[model samples]
Target chain A: MLSVNVRLFGTLSRTFEDYHHSCGLDIAIASRGDIHDLLVHLDLIGESIGMVFMDDKQVNNTTKLNDNARIKIFQPIFGG
Target chain B: MNIVRVDMNARKITREIFEPAFTGMGGRGLTSFFINREVPPGCDPLGPDNKLVFAPGFFSGSTLVNTSRFSIGAKSPMTRGIKESNVGGTVAADMARTGISAIIVEGRPNNGQSFILKVDQKGDVTLHDADQYWGKRTYDLVASIKEFYGNKISITCIGPAGEQQLSAASIQATDRDGRPCRAAGRGGLGAVMGSKGLKALIIEKSATNAEPIQDLEGFKASAKIFAKAVMDDEFSAEILPELGSAVLVEPINAAGAFPTRNAREGQFEDADKISGEALAQIIKSRGGKPNHKGCSGCIINCSNEYVDEKGEFITSSLEYETIWSMGGMIGNNDLDSIARLDRLCDDIGLDTMSTGVAVAVAMDAGYKEFGDAKAAIEMVEDVARGTAFGKILGHGPEMVGKHFNHDRVPVVKGQSIAAYDPRAIQGMAVTYSTSPMGADHTAGWVVDSNLEAFGGTLDPFSAQGQVENSRNTQIHMAMVDTVGICDFAQTGFGAPDGLENVCKMIAAKSGKPFCEADWKSTGKMIIQTELEFNKNAGFTKEQDRLPRMFYEEPLPPHNKVVVIQDDDMDSTFAF
Candidate 1:
């Protein structure tokens, strides 16, 4: 079992919980599962995520998320 | 049109006819024009030769929304470069009402005596003795001036810091509540006003029958549409009034670009303490007003008055830049402390953003501890007193950095970076680097696609296509400024035909046949003029580069440095 910690920001923070509490992903995949696939398995729309981060490093939305990696997603919204 | 010249040294008021070429330009264009034509490069900015010009935009007195901004221009005593700062207040509209185009203060008072310039509807100007009001704070001075001139008149006054000729001094303007809160607050223009021996400028509402626009009905039609669009928009209608500009805290913090602790880190650990949500809660608990209040003829009022827990006034118009500078940047999340600091800046006539950055830099240099809100407030108070350390901080961010021997100062071209950190918002980085005005975020603020379809990379962290996005936004911003409207109205420009409607509005007001091409041409012309002024003022491509700290420090979360190369910076000016 692989557990991925997810955090949301901006409009995503407003719409979804900052931390997803014990969400289960149906896929049992290798280390090469892209973020798009992860979102798809979680029933999340790709357009809602503007930027993605994995392990404190900014990665493209298409970049793969490793097992036990911490992922942060930001929606397209501006303040000020 | 006339130029009212106030000579504080000789206590003389002279009126001169406005040149025809300067007939249409106001606000930024008028100030930039005056600086370019009149001010001698390399002249002592504090000396009598440097002049400060105050002009209202063309549509300032009309029914147009967000058209009430006034511009103040002078060769900066701090940066020793061209400076133009604008603020929203009733004074600009009142000036237009008095059948005056602009007021130019030339030469200096031979003696150290300060005076006030008073103007009435009959075009009469008087230089009154202001010795009694010299050292008074902005609030006290405004109250006294109002008592003397009646509440109907609008006055722009400087505080003790300006009277002392502090380099970071600002000129304060009264808001609707009669608080000296709004400011023409940048580039030490208040010092220029002080150098001329002027304490304040009082403008009585015009009794003359003068209309601002040529075609009233046509202008009214277009302005109504524009105002409706602004008021009807979800972002402007919903978020702005509720949060003011403090709404930016969370997103910028998330992007690792919130400018924490004098730019040492891009994100603040205590951002939640000062976020817009937090501010809303405070306002609700304290029974503070949260709706938009107009400056003059503005219907889309984005300004608010914030009150403290004891029902005491803290500050009016708590903005995003102020929140970021005093809260996140200094690592002080105390809203009350931030409000007090803001009030200090307002009362003393200083730039809050620059002063905050200076204080943060001082803290980094071991002059004060991080998150020392009281100490930070004290340092700002020193600026008013002209104390030894206050003098250092009053010189602005670059000088303060040098004084403290801090190498991590985030300033470009001697001006401190605004609230947005460039490493997080790459388009903003381009704007800060390449803008003629050093490190001004408003030069080209990037609107999110959801807010406005500015059409750029959805991901702010990506450098790809940011330069082009910035350039396009800059052009649009120039057009907005030229039209004398607030950039907050930009959400309406998202529609395909929005630019055409803007042109239509201009055509109706000026009686000129303006079209989309005309708008583009005017924007290009404004940019070219600014570029020419900078070039003549000895600014080169080297000055356009970001500070070295951005390249060295890897911002957290993203852990990415400002990777835009010098070549990319050079290419920005290729246009």
Candidate 2:
């Protein structure tokens, strides 16, 4: 059992939430499951969501997740 | 059907019949064609041999939404290379309505006297004395021209930097709100215009009965479909209109692709201060409008005019690239100061992106401190004034880097890179490297990973599938530029089959038959022609490379260096 949190920004933020908050996803996975599998378990699709961070350090979508590792996901939006 | 040639030396205007080869091409294609056809290769870009071309897209006068883009082309005095800068304004539509396809300004004035070009109905062109408007900024100069030519005339003008013939000068265009807000702001086209002793071009919207299209109804149907797709798409409709393009700050920052501190890092510490949310908040608090505003017949209305606190005017069309280049890339997070600097760049006829990069390089050289908004504003002002240091800054990032002895300048083929750092977004790295224009993001913006999800061995991080993606995107963008449509319209209709309807519309209008594949081929042909022009002008595969610093420095967040090998870069153009 592990806990992960996600937050959206820009278009996703507007469409999802006003500020960063916990996603509150609790799931039971086999030992040594990676973050990619966790994202699938949490129903995240492709690069539609841009950056993923684990405990403040940037990580790719395929990064492995540890027990009780905090995660955040942000979606793409416009800028110059 | 006619080409207007304005000889600055003789102050004479000559007209010639248009050739069929140049019938459909306009904007970038037209500029490139003119440069390749008329200007001699290896000629001094700042000398009399160099020619400046102003051309509107083929469908500029039509009811096609957001099709009012015009291009300015010149052998760049800045890059000493081929240059084409495009902008959205009413001048293109007005020129099309007045039955003019292109305007070619040639030869410098022998006596060194400056003048303005006035074109009205019946194609009458006059060179008016512009000594009084000399050294005036574009904002004030535009107002003076409007006051004299009446409110309806479309004017393209330059400013003090242009009058000084600085290498970084841009050509200014009037936006919907009558501000000199839009610009062809790259490669010092304004310097070319200024070298011709031209101050401004005032075009009167003529009521001439010139209908070039053959099938209006079919064209209208195709245009409607294209417009519907853009208006209905989630990205174009909801996001672009609501936030303009500046909304990418947060996402690109989070992705660690945002260029910061002169491309030294991919993330900004003050990202939240310059985020799109901050911009939206400012717009809402100041009673500013954030909806889509059209350029000519455009319905997408992705352009914005933002006002600041104290209810004073700030800037128009506050874009994402400009914000990033001036804000994060330079390490300046003051929004109001950034807006003021944007206005200064617009008034001086300079590319904000290049200017921002140059200023940051200046800061990195210890000329100014990082994140000093006041110093940044003063440095830009110095460029407008053409001071000694200003000349260094106005020459662009490469020159600035050279003068400062900084080896980490992030330029490709002498032109500064856009907002996205190549070390972070490797797909855009391919674009910056291989693009003929050199470091241009619009050659192909490869951030569209959500488009139908084509499964393949195409990895975004590695340079594995970037070549094909860049080639495909270049073709698509070329088609969009030719039709005078906004690139945002392609979000809904960028696919091969989607372009079929657009080509059908073009065919109907031109009384020709064009299929989906024909449209695709047209894009390929445009790129091939551009590539040939660049190759002839001395560009080679060696020029198609990212700066060495990108390969050396590991960007933050991801902390990944661009590990693309030289041979892999050579294979990008393997066709």
Candidate 3:
């Protein structure tokens, strides 16, 4: 199992009342787990997440997660 | 619908039916077509030969949601090119309800006099003396006008910056609350109004006289479908209303395209502090209203009222662009100072993007230290005070860069680039370099489609497929602006039957057959007219290129320069 750091942004932060913005939530996932598995593990599978970033790089659902990877999840952003 | 012509030189007003050539055109379509046909291309932008036009979107007076987009267009003193800046407010709906399509201001006043134009609910047009209101700021001017005309009228006016003919000046339009907060804040159209010696326009509100729909039943049906589509889109219905446009701060910064510290850095260290989430939290804690409606008939309500710690009004509708401009661009993390600067720009009638970029250029040239919020506030105040340095800043970033001999200025044809840096998002590079509107983000927003995490297919760092994408997007936006649809409300077009429903509405209004192909053709026509106008105004292919910094400098994080070829950029308008 690999422990990865995850930060939830916008309204997603409110879902976890104990979540702190500066201190990201850490979750253990299977060594071969990908973004999809992580979403299922975090119970955000059906949530409205606009974008997901791993190590500051945009990643897709099938992208593999690495140990200590920095993950950031954001809601939809409407640019003017 | 009728077009009103105000001849300032003769102090005359005339009403005329639309010529067959100009029928079925409104908003940007009418403004660009009229300027291309009547105004001399090579004339000085602020001279008498130049014309200023105010037009509403085609669906303004209808029962549609969020269609009150009003376009103000002219040859811009800042870019020396054709420009259109649209604002969302009650004015468009009010003018449309009065059965007016466009108001054309022609020929500057010969005598050194100022005047105000009034359009009554009965559609009668009159010119009044505005000597007493000539130098008043937009807020005070709107207040005075509303006091005299009752609270029912909408006033589109300029501030002292416009009277000074500053290139960064903007035309301020009153929102639904009768506050002059919504702004046509690009292209320096306010200077053109000032050059014409026009102070304000008081348009009487009307509950009757909406543009007659030939097939009212059909129009209503299509409008219902379109409105539902907008409401169904998660971005429009949920995200925007909850977080406002400032929600972009996190995603854009995460994508490494936020354009922080004058484009030297792609991400701001304090981005989280001035982000949309922080803004909403602050507003809620301070008793400010979020999810507020600033435009008429707007259901999404992406606007907000920012108040001070004491719960006093600071400004209404603190937007994403302004937050990026005053926060990350100048390296200021203080949201309070940014809100104050936003209010000052609104009151003084200046473009916050241009003004902020000008200050950033000055700070980059060592005129002041970066992150000095007080200095940033004072420089913007200087433009309002008309200080010697203020006049230079009001001319925008290019002038400030030249004054300080700085080569890192991020401008295309004198207009400052918006929040998005082109190096990180190559599609934006193509859009900024090729757009006739001069680095305007709204001209072609390919940001979302270029970021892979956001379900975008295009590679943000690649040149392949960027030109074609930008060209199509620009064409679509030209027609979107032509029809006067708010960009936010355009989530409707993403629905399964969105385009078809909109076509039905257009066909219902014109009593003519319309389809998607006609939409493309109309957009293409508008752009072709603008490109021709720019060419005749002495612009060449060289003017359709980005500044050297974007090509040479490697922005932090991504460290990628604009990779789009010049040939690709020139081919963007080949259609």
Would you list the C-alpha lDDT of every candidate in the order shown?
A: 0.74, 0.77, 0.88
Model 3 Cα lDDT, one tens digit per residue, B1-575: 58999999999899898853533578899899888888898999999999999999888878878899999989999989899999998999999999989999999888879989998998889999999898898899988877777998989999988988999999999998889998999989889999999989889997487779988999898888888888988889887887898988888998888988888999998998998888988999899997799998999999999999999988989989999999999999999999999999999999999999999999999999999989998998898889989999988998899899998888887888999999999999988888888989999999978876566789999998899888999999998897888999998887677887888888898788888888888888899999999999999989889988889999889899999988989999976
The sequence of per-residue lDDT tens digits that candidate 2 reaches over residues A1-80 is 55455554445544333443223344566567776786676556543655667776667656778777766555544222
lDDT of 2 by residue, B317-405 (tens): 78888898889988998888888889999998888988999988888888788899999999998987788988888878888999989
Worst 10 contiguous positions by lDDT, candidate 3 chain B = B17-26
Which DockQ value does candidate 1 get? 0.15
Better of 1 and 2 by DockQ: 2
Which 10 successive residues of model 1 chain B have the least lDDT summed? Answer: B449-458
Q: What's the distance in Å from true for residue B425, model 1?
A: 1.8
Measured with C-alpha atoms, the lDDT of residue A68 in candidate 1 is 84
Query: What's the CA RMSD for each of the models?
Result: 4.6, 3.8, 1.6
- Give the CAPRI class of candidate 3: medium
* Reference-based lDDT, residue B84, model 3: 91
Interface RMSD of each: 4.8, 4.3, 1.8
Candidate 1 on B1-575: residue-level lDDT in tens? 66787766677778887753523456777777777778776688888878898888766777776777788888877656677778887878788777777888988878788888988877688888889888899988988888888887778889877776777789998876667899888778888888888999887875463345777788777777777777776556666666667767765676677788887788887887787667766877798775658487766566766788887778888888898888888889899899889999999998898889888888888888889999998998887787988888877778888987777777877788898788766777788888777787777787463122223444666666777777776766665654456656665564447677767766766666778876666666666676776777677888887888787777776677776677776676576
TM-score of 3: 0.97
* 2 or 3, greater by TM-score: 3
Clashing pairs in 3: none
TM-score of each: 0.88, 0.90, 0.97
